[model samples]
Target: MEGRNGDAVSLLERYLKDWADESLHAKLAQVFAATNMLQDSLSHYQAALRINPQNEAATADGPKHIETTLSLF
Candidate 1:
């Protein structure tokens, strides 16, 4: 990303278009979080949970991260 000057968000979004897996969504959520795209991150996290209610990471950390992100706004 630093070398190519490419948009990481766009790349992730493109990958999502092809596959909508829970793990992929979780990964996208982390990438979005790293980029400060909180809303998008939260959405992906929620999507992951919707796909698999037992998703431990999303279930445990999603709400906390969402709260933290909203607090910034």
Candidate 2:
């Protein structure tokens, strides 16, 4: 389980490095959030938003996610 989790993380990191597109970044943020990696998730989300302030998903869904993630602290 641990090794699988590590592999998944590595894959996500590679994806982030290779394709920094907003949608992919958002997906990665969600994955990080699901894994309780709030800081990393927030960072990715912020990057996504920065890349596309007019992003439909970010504009429509990001604030809620950010608030929820922040509340986890």
Candidate 3:
């Protein structure tokens, strides 16, 4: 996906529609985090956490993203 974050997001979102995979949501959240789409990233991060609170990626990275997004306001 060579920096094609949009493509990655589209793929993850498409698959997520059929099945709510925690890792997919986590990955999508990271992709959005890398871009300026903070809200989208936060949503996915929350989704992943909702599915599996023990998810290390979401637990670790989600708060950082949320804090960063919140700081923007």
Candidate 4:
């Protein structure tokens, strides 16, 4: 899991450096959420929403991710 998460972060960061878009941010947020990096996920999710308010995936999943993260505490 750790290795997979690290790879996801690395790939996402590399992609983010070349492109900046709501979809990319949303994907990164999803990756982070999968890895239990809730804060980073939330930040990216917010950035995605800020860039495109109509992002259905982010809008639908972001709150669920946050809720799941919060439940861990």
lDDT of each: 0.75, 0.73, 0.85, 0.83
The digit string of per-residue lDDT tens for model 3 on 1-73 reads 5469888988998999999989999999899888867888888888898999988889895568577867879
Please, what's the RMSD in Å of model 1?
Answer: 2.8
Which model is ahead, 3 or 4, in terms of TM-score? Answer: 3
Question: Candidate 1: where are CA atoms >4 Å away?
Answer: 1-8
Clashing pairs in 1: none
lDDT of 4 by residue, 21-50 (tens): 888899888888888778888888888889
Of 1 and 4, the candidate ahead on TM-score is 4
CA-RMSD of model 3: 2.1
**Residue range with the least summed lDDT across 10 consecutive positions in model 2:** 55-64
lDDT of 2 by residue, 1-73 (tens): 5566567767877887888889877776776766767778778777889999876665656547667858877
* Segments in model 3 whose C-alpha atoms lie over 4 Å from true places: 1-3
The lDDT ranking, best first, is 3, 4, 1, 2
Candidate that would win on TM-score: 3
Candidate 1, residue 48: how far the Cα is off, in Å: 0.5
TM-score of 3: 0.84
